[model samples]
Target chain A: DQQVKQNSPSLSVQEGRISILNCDYTNSMFDYFLWYKKYPAEGPTFLISISSIKDKNEDGRFTVFLNKSAKHLSLHIVPSQPGDSAVYFCAASGGYGNKLVFGAGTILRVKS
Target chain B: EPEVTQTPSHQVTQMGQEVILRCVPISNHLYFYWYRQILGQKVEFLVSFYNNEISEKSEIFDDQFSVERPDGSNFTLKIRSTKLEDSAMYFCASTVQSEKLFFGSGTQLSVL
Candidate 1:
């Protein structure tokens, strides 16, 4: 399904810089947006999330911005570190099943 | 912190063989879900289970696929007859209310 899409397949950023990953969704019924980080040979780990009612959510160095009007969402990592290099996936929950729909994922490479 | 656990980190089976992937979700979580990701693809929802029954399933979950919580803490996905396309990483996730899904390390299945 093309409900969620991550147009950029990869992104590179220098350490201590801001890393922004973007995602878009065609389904307006989605109310909750989530970000996940995964390393090679591992499953995705929950990073952060935002609800449609709110514009932003932050935890530690990770932040998520949601623009419901544009059907877009983004994850921002401030002062990115090498440990932050991984595949990041954007997912949405809603639209009938309480099941999550995920994007193809964007690979983030934080260069030290 | 508690984390979801999956067994058989990798499994290689012949085509048409029946395979069962097992998972143990976090204790206190009320909802369970199964997702799969083919090589270089996005994670796709397979099924959601709650209260001893499957609440929802995706179109990808066809006649050959089934899910069960045979016990209080264990959840399992069964493929009656696996095909080459079935090869992928299977992740088990649990959440409290369709929010913040905690996922396991994943079980990689290879159907030959």
Candidate 2:
């Protein structure tokens, strides 16, 4: 079963606009959430992360907001640039061991 | 900045042949993990290793699959008697603490 899900397969937005990607999880035990961006033929690079204790986390142009009661999270990029056109994956993990459950990924296309 | 790296960007192997995929995680990271993604699918966790031993593994990690740190710098995954269903992109990741994972470019294995 897919514990983490990203229902949107693709999204398109104009440059300088806000781009939002959403994710949901069924497991309440997951205490950490992360977002990664991937380009074709390249590894996923760390974008931002949020702890269960906090409802939101922001880094540069990327912000992640988590809603524990709804088991939902989202990543928002402000002033989206063409370089932000890539697949974004949402991942969740519980305590220590370091195994992550990843979403199917959302392909974002920022048109210039 | 250090990043995880994998060798043999692409490999084509005959069914039933054994194959080995190698990875070198960040130098100072202490935890290691392996995940795989079939085309059009989400990334799935396979195993996690720490202190030279496997800490946890998913059901997908069967007898045919094995992981080893071999030496200080190299982490490898070996598949014995590979099957066509095993063909996928395998990623190696590492983390120093928390849930932030740095993933490698991945080795795309094709079993014919």
lDDT of 1 by residue, A18-45 (tens): 9999999999888999999999889899
Backbone clashes, candidate 1: 0
lDDT of 2: 0.93
Q: Which runs in model 2 stand beyond 4 Å of their true positions?
A: none
True lDDT of residue A23, candidate 1: 99
Q: Compose the digit string of candidate 1's lDDT tens values, residues B1-112.
A: 9999999899999999999999999999889999999999899999999888899989999999999888799999999999999999999999876577889999999999
| Candidate of highest DockQ | 2
DockQ of each: 0.62, 0.78
Q: Candidate 1: misplaced stretches above 4 Å? A: A95-97
lDDT of 1 at A30: 89
Clashing pairs in 2: none
